[model samples]
Target chain A: MKELSLNILDIVENSTKAKAELVEIEIIEDKTTLTVRITDDGSGMSEETLLSVTDPFYTTRTTRKVGMGIPLFRLAAEQTGGSLTITSHHIDDYPEEHGTVVNASFDKSHIDFTPLGDIVSTITTLIQGHPDVDFKFTHTVDDSSVSLDTRELREVLDDIPLDNFEVLLWIKDNLIEQYNKIKYK
Target chain B: MKSLAELQAIKERMKNKIVLREGTGDIRVVVGMATCGIAAGARPVLAAFVEEVSNAGLNDKVTVSQTGCVGYCQLEPIVEIYEAGKDKVTYIHMTADKAKEVVEKHLKGGKIVAEYTVTDDN
Candidate 1:
């Protein structure tokens, strides 16, 4: 579960670095099923790159790929009696193009929600810090659901940058605050 | 829920003092923050730069920026230093402590710490 969140952080960082205008993250947790799906509108990879992504030693990134991120995600899902799948396409909805959707699933009954809040906080803070990027997060716990659209916050800012350190800290704190509101007693 | 008014106060304070001017500086410290960089502890290195610079009131003369990759995967937590008119100095296996020293000696005292620089051999 911990590695799962770390992988999500790494993948989301890639999305933002790709200059993605919009990024979507969905987490569904139920007693019997746990699923995490992250989609990005950033630059997609080629077929060759896609095949190499799962290899712990192969990565298109120039820096140390640690190449273990996606593999770790796959292992977490498989160990918990689930599977991981990925689909990539271009900007025009063509399968031959470049965008990516990585979906990993696990047995919810065996997972822990303690770390879920951290995952959400990481995403929210990254988005808040990088105001140039927009993030849409939808989280579901069994049947209860919550969604946060940064676009609305963007409207409040009139599209100005939210890179101020204090503002970014507030965003991170608020995400933790909101998560505690919904998850903890 | 913080608003632009708070940012305005920051801007006002910044206007009264010197601020960062991108791409035109005597020294530029670029931290590699791609996936590998993060895994290898680039975030702390980067954060230390910000903290140390702001603490020393050199945020104007020193600029810290993040770059995706420098094609040096083996050197994950790499930092590149470029002075006003000197050659680019690449430092490998950087820790937050070493970064602080770079700021003090190289940046403040104007001496190139060659031991930390990327060279043929240690």
Candidate 2:
């Protein structure tokens, strides 16, 4: 559960690093079959780069090894009786450019899905008011579905414009609090 | 399982005493939260800042925040202090202990810690 939130945060950081104008986030959970998945649209890696990212020493950013974040997410999912897959294209492949799609799946029965909703909410809230960027998040519980489109929310929601620094921390604090509040149940 | 009623109560309490009022003089303490910062133990540093500020009852005086990719991954746990009327002070490679000192010496005492400052000499 902790890894999931950290994964989302790490991917968003990657999106910003990629200078991506749009990112799509999707989460699906099923109680009966017990499955969960998270996918993202950010700078997709080249074939060589994609293969190397899974290596612990491989890193694209000078900040640190990318292996810790995404690799950890992949490990978490597999440890929970599931799997993770990543797909990406080289920069020259598309006219508009391409982004990476990281798909990590977990067995809901092995873990828990109650906290998943808050994860979706947290991601949406964190990406709020970044007009240049858009995220589409979808959540599924049992047979029920709740998806949020940030672009649509932009039209109806009064996005309290906040500077990057404090609001981001508040978002993290609130997300952790909310996740804890909902998790055990 | 937690109930929706509990969430509603949280919302009500939060709405009643929102600390983010218009006139409150906001002090922004920005922590570097990029990959380098995270790997170099910035999360604990960030948490220490928050805990100390809240514990000291200085929540109104200062607000702890985070920023991504400050472009100085070399200085992993970088912190930038932004006061309303003063030039920003950048502090690099901070630890939780150092962060607490920053809070006591700088935030509360209004005196910056020269050792951690990112001045030209240092």
> Which number leads on lDDT?
1
lDDT of 1 at B112: 77
Candidate 1 per-residue C-alpha lDDT over B1-122 given as tens digits, one digit per residue, 9 for 90 to 100: 34446545545554443334444456788887665665676666776775676676665577677776687756768999877668898988889998899888887778877887877763
lDDT of 1 by residue, A1-185 (tens): 24455567667776776557788889887767768898888877667777887888886554444566677677777777788898776444564445678898877676433234356445643553356878888877766776667776555554344544444454555556655667732
Clashing pairs in 1: A44-A98, A89-A97, A90-A97, A90-A98
For model 1, the local distance difference test gives 0.68
Q: Give the best candidate by DockQ.
A: 1
Instruction: Tell me the TM-score of model 1.
Output: 0.70
lDDT of 2 at A93: 72
Error of 1 at B108 (Å): 5.4
**C-alpha TM-score for every candidate:** 0.70, 0.60
Per-model clash counts, in order, read 4, 6
Worst 10 residues of 1 chain B by lDDT: B15-24
